[model samples]
Target: TLQPDVFGLVEAARILCEDGFAVFPYTTDDLIVAERLLAAGCKVLMPWCAPIGSALGPINIMALRSMRGYFPGVPLIVDA
Candidate 1:
């Protein structure tokens, strides 16, 4: 289940676990996958607002907060 996608979600998650952070120049629209990652002790850093080359904002603060709640120790960064 590692390297979940060609974009390297699992690898990025691994690196994040090891390095405390990992950046992937792409987007993941699958919230379930993100939740799974969070459940696996990996922070799901994803965008909830806008799209690539758009303004940054928290489209769903509640969802972000919920994600945070799911992973109390994991850090989720929303980079639009």
Candidate 2:
């Protein structure tokens, strides 16, 4: 599994791994990290929407497409 946020995600992944889960945290705000996650057999999970009450749409189509290219079977959910 992969998380967008860095702070809490690392801890969550670490704990999950300790609990025998095959967890991997993708924290770096870099596309290379996404590819690495895929190479390491992680499913990408990104929030392609604004936070809470915000109204913005998908701001990174290229990045999204790149992720899709790497993990087409991995589910993509828009938290709108």
Candidate 3:
């Protein structure tokens, strides 16, 4: 679920939403990515709890918190 191509994901999500499908996107710790995903009708996001395959936990707490702030009520799944 480590989708590096944010714009591609956004376009896909937008299409899905238009077709009445709920979109759950996986985003890195990029706030801009989250914003665009939300705009594309993503009600929830799955962000990395740590780098993929690193086995670390919540590497950037500040970034996570910032993402939460940016989304407010949006649900974020911090994938590990």
Clashing pairs in 1: none
| 63 Cα displacement, candidate 2 (Å) | 1.3
For candidate 2, the TM-score is 0.50
Q: What lDDT score goes with residue 27 in model 3?
A: 69
Q: Each model's C-alpha lDDT? A: 0.53, 0.54, 0.83
List the candidates ranked by TM-score, beginning with the highest.
3, 2, 1
C-alpha RMSD of each candidate structure in angstroms: 6.0, 5.2, 1.9
lDDT string for model 3 (13-73, tens) is 8999989998877668898888888888889998777877777677899998988887889
Q: After superposition, how far is residue 28 of candidate 1 from its true place, in Å?
A: 4.1
Give stretches of model 1 more than 4 Å off.
1-31, 38-49
Model 1 scores a TM of 0.47
- Compute the lDDT of residue 61 as modeled in candidate 3: 91
Instruction: Compose the digit string of candidate 1's lDDT tens values, residues 14-74.
Output: 5666666544323344456666555444634554444545455556667667666765664
Q: How do all models score by TM-score?
A: 0.47, 0.50, 0.85
Cα error, residue 20 of model 2, in Å, equals 5.9
Number of the predicted model whose TM-score against the real structure is largest:
3
lDDT of 2 by residue, 1-80 (tens): 33366545655655665576765453443456545544444455453444444566655667667766766786655455
Cα-based lDDT at residue 35, candidate 1: 62
> Residue 33 deviation, candidate 1, in Å?
1.2
